[model samples]
Target: MWQKSPNHQSLSEEEESKALKKAPSLRFRFILAGVLVIGIIASLAINLIFDYSQKLADLSYDRLLRSALLQMDENVGLIRNEVSIDIPWSAFATLAQAEEDRVFYKVESLEQGFITGYQDLNSFPPNPPVLDQIQFYDQMFSGEMVRFAWVQRYITDPETAQTVRIILGQTRLSREEMAAAVTQKAVEVVVLIALVAITLIIIGSHLVLRPLHRIERALEERVMGDLTPIDINTPKETHHLKVAINHFMARLQANLEQLENYTADAAHQLRTPLASLRALAENARDIGYSNSASPEKQHQALESIVQQCDTLSQTVTLLLNQAVVSHRLQTHRLELMDLLVPITASCREQALTALRQGVHLSLECELKESLILGDSFSIQQMMQNLIENAVRYSQQDQDAPAEVIVQVMEFDLFYRIKVIDYGEGIPESEKERVFERFYRGRYDVAGTGVGLSMVRDIVNHHSARVNILNTEPKGTTFQVDFAKHRFDGDNQ
Candidate 1:
């Protein structure tokens, strides 16, 4: 028993991965998106870092204010039972050590009322038992945004205990100066880094994309019919692309050869018909007046010439169609379309011709909604050739009418189209050769003998199969199976 190979089914991702690994990689030029993303992220990071640095500088200065306020906390005490106090000069010295900043202090005793300091500076409430707690906030002092710190302490006289809050506030000249200096430094560093990144992106982009530019120039400077494989050895990333281009050039060369053969064949095949037409024409022109039937003979000669011309035109058309099918097999794209739409239209178009030949042509489909993916023109060409062959070859007899049936049937995993003709059936031995170009059956029928050949090419290009089967006892059937042709990405 013959068995099909298991590897003929769908592709595995592992195989695709291996194939991609073997092929030359086409790397993306990351200069554009990479630079944009990096620039945005770096800008945000620099701003965050600089802003945090400013807050950190202000926080360190807040510690200084807390220190001076602690000193005031220790200074407030009940002396001689009068709840008196003296301000420390060193505390003021610490607060006064600012570049272009004015400092203020206030000391208030909960029991001693005011201890000879700015009383309005005690406007903010301290956060509970400020024994070891130092609170900082922003406030308005002398019509400017000032940073303030609050502290509280308890002092005992061995008999009476009293508590007071020490609050100190300062104008924000020193903190502003610190923030400006740090941000300026940060800006300079960011600018430098940006310049370095931009330079690297420029140089890297030129280095990476240089191979593509070279390939472009090679294509541009190429002469006519120059399909030589490009020898680009640098930039390993574009290696696969170069190889693909070379393969395409080779295919193009083959197509050009096919076209040349088509032209040569066309000229060679028309020679016999054209020579016969010319001989008949010359004979008609020289038909002597010695016979009374010369006029009738001339008319018959003109009719024969017409028939030969039709045969030549059909031969040329089929050859042209064959060439087009060959070219499209390489470069055509598959499209999603309805199979019934074009099928019905083609049958309608050929109905009159079939009628003229004493043939009854009809179409039938098992499914009403049939979807197929293919190139419409190529599929149409294949269908037209098959059905027209059936129409032309259907047996005409005195006993019964000639009939050609076109049927589309749905199977488990594929679609089948059969063009069945109740004609003198094709013999089993000659069936295979009928698809070869310019090869006809043993019967002396008028045909260009290239229709079935073009059909074979079209079917193979679509990855489908066509089989010839002897139908019943006296007819022939051409069956084509259009299997599922799915790309890997389309499934995903």
Candidate 2:
């Protein structure tokens, strides 16, 4: 008993289709997008923090100025109208010293409207009572820049409707100091927030992209020839990557299988012809020495020797053609007409040989002009093999005629060449096997069994298709269809 080979099992068309549907990998793209989003958010947050800090500083400074103005108002209201009440420096000084040591106070008398308290008091601007609204103003006093809050009060004598203005002023050091502190605190907070945000972003990015690192490692560990499916089950966002990798592996496995089959077929076909030549040579040498007496006998032996040599030569030629076509399939440029002309010429010679065998050979070309892109020599060899096979197999029945027909038709997008032979046609079941190397039909014929197989190879190399069909009356037809090519004459 023998175990079946793994390659013997056919791949399901559905599975192959699904493999093609696998999504492409986007791990790097995902990471890049995430980084960009994080950067944008961080930038926006930093700007907001700076704006908020400046607003807070402004609010704190305004509040300090309002508090200073309220203190000055309270002191001025205590002045008596009956007599000029001079305010003690200690009174406003105490209030100013409580918040800021660098305090300045100024008061101008309402009675005489004269400079009072300090000579610097005359430099202070008088406040308007109705203009008690908080406003920031700048002034130069004692040759130094200073900012301050001032308030004005009215003292009315009961007997008179006249009003006297008493002005009180103080230095703005406490409010300025408060504004500075608020600004410094806001700067520290912004710095701390930025640091925290940067740290978190770094950590988040790594966590988000950690799965990609696993995929990379898995890929690196894989062997060059290993086409096994990836084992990792990724997140939904990363599933496309899994699908793409699996698709690539499937194609790789398929190509590898095809390579293996080609290699095996080549070995099997070449081995027998080589062995036959070797045996024939050895036998010829033996006969040469054993029967040296008869010249006629020697001549017969020489003819046999020549026939064997011819067989070997044909085999080598077919092999070389197959190899050349396989190579040209990868890298070659050929015009359609160039390939067809040579193939037709080669097959005409084979058709002439068939005529001696009592088989009629006919050519029917429906198109005046046709062209394709392929390897010319391979196409020639393919045509020769098809014609030879037809000649060999066309049954010679005295009652019925034997004939081989070659037809070429050109359609809008393709050119089709068919070789039809009227012989014992192939059974439907065996049609596919005719293209396998070394596979022969039930009919007895002198053949290397590689003729039709070579035809199939050459057609495949040109990215074309071959159809084997039975004609209406009798015999089988091998149809070769060449796909259309887009070409600019200059490029060719």
Candidate 3:
């Protein structure tokens, strides 16, 4: 019923293309993840470098403002109990070292109101500093960010004391430029490192996946329909994959061999019957044309043609059953089942087939159930073929009463099935040859010679043994023995 399509190859190719597109590339994913991790780490490093540079730049410039404030504090005096001060030239000179920056300074007396330089500098709310101590702060003055250092001093002449404040501020142009330069250098180094890491990621991923590429190339180079086992050197990680592929190919090779044999045998065995049918049909046509020939002769020719057709149909059926059993032996998984089921079923079917021969077929299964690890389809095929072989040979003698007996017996270690036929027994010389494909004995019986061959194959598949023995008076008994405990421990 299941036939291979004419365009099966093309459809498989299309499906393979779709599958490749849908499958994610392992190398590409690894590289992408590595790049993403490098990008995140590089960004964090850049931010940390920027912050460190900004703090370093600020530390360098704050010392200059403090020196200028200290110099101005030393120049303050308390003459006539009133605040008086002379600003030092060195204080302003030190502030002028930053060429691109603007500077501002102020000196004031708290109790006596505004004193010496830059009264408008009061825009910054001044916090009183500890005596003789310097305090630094920053603020926006005249639309520019400024850094300021403040210092306070008290002068006493035994009459009255006055508190004076010295403050100096500078624009932050040079400090900002220094921080930007340091950050730019660090960023360049980080970008270079990231690029190097990404390049290494690509190379490493390629090396790790080289084995897979080798396997693909090996398969691509093989000829189509080559089911031989693949032999190639591979790493331990991929060795199991190679083994699995070899196993699959071995099964496929076996199936193809079975199909080829079935096709050839079916053609060879069916040829004679087909040719006989054609001859009978031609003979019947000739008999009809002859006026001298009686109608009874034409009827006899028609009957012979019908008989040939039946033989052809039976041969075809046996060939198909052989093919089905061979295929199932390759593909079907064995399971725990009762062996008696197929045996009884085969007995019933063969009994109906032998009814026309006036042969009495009987089943003798004493056990309720005989459990075994086996493929049911193959077991059924074996039973059917064995019983059919017996039924065909049992009706050889027309004088004696024909009888075929199918028996199932169980033992401690194994199970035995026997098909006994009361017919002209087979000689010891031809017993083994009868199991060969299309090898029939010299008996006038309707048969295709495929049943016994199928039985032999099924027996070999189950690792069982078969024997043929002559009965007491006149008959042949085909005995098949199967081990009961085969693969039972493996299941556990």
Of the candidates shown, which would achieve the greatest lDDT relative to the real structure?
Answer: 3
lDDT string for model 3 (286-398, tens) is 99999899988988999999889988988888888887887788778777888888888777777778887788899887799788878887888888887777777776776
What Cα-based lDDT does every candidate model obtain?
Answer: 0.78, 0.66, 0.84
Where is model 3 poorest over a 10-residue stretch in terms of lDDT? 122-131
Stretches of candidate 1 off by over 4 Å are 1-42, 125-129, 234-251, 286-300, 320-369, 374-380, 391-403, 408-415, 422-424, 483-492
1-492 in candidate 2: lDDT tens per residue? 123355643445556567756854354455566566656766676667556655564455445555654654445432333324445545554555436534454555455454344554554355534534444444666555455555444544565322333333344455456556665665566567656766676677677777788888888787667778888967886789888988988877876786677677667766876787777767667777884547776677677778777777776677667666666654567655644586568767877788888888888875555667776777887888888888777854445567888888877778888888878788999997888877888534666677787787677767888998887787788988897675777357
Candidate number with greatest TM-score: 1
Poorly placed runs, candidate 3 (over 4 Å): 1-17, 28-201, 228-232, 398-401, 485-492
Better of 1 and 2 by TM-score: 1
Instruction: Give per-residue CA lDDT, model 1, range 1-492, as digits (tens).
Output: 123356643355567778877886433336666678778977897888788877977887887787788777776667776566677888878877785788877776788787777867655744555564678878887788888887777777777887777778888888888888888888778878877987887788777888898998988788878888897675677898899999998888887887788887777777767897798777766664447656778788788778888877877777777778777777878777777776787788878889888888999886886667777777887888888888777744334348888899987668888988887778888988999877978436777777898889888877889999987757789999887545578678
What is the TM-score of each predicted model, taking all chains together?
0.78, 0.56, 0.63
Worst ten-residue run, lDDT, model 2?
Answer: 160-169
Winner by lDDT between candidate 2 and candidate 1? 1
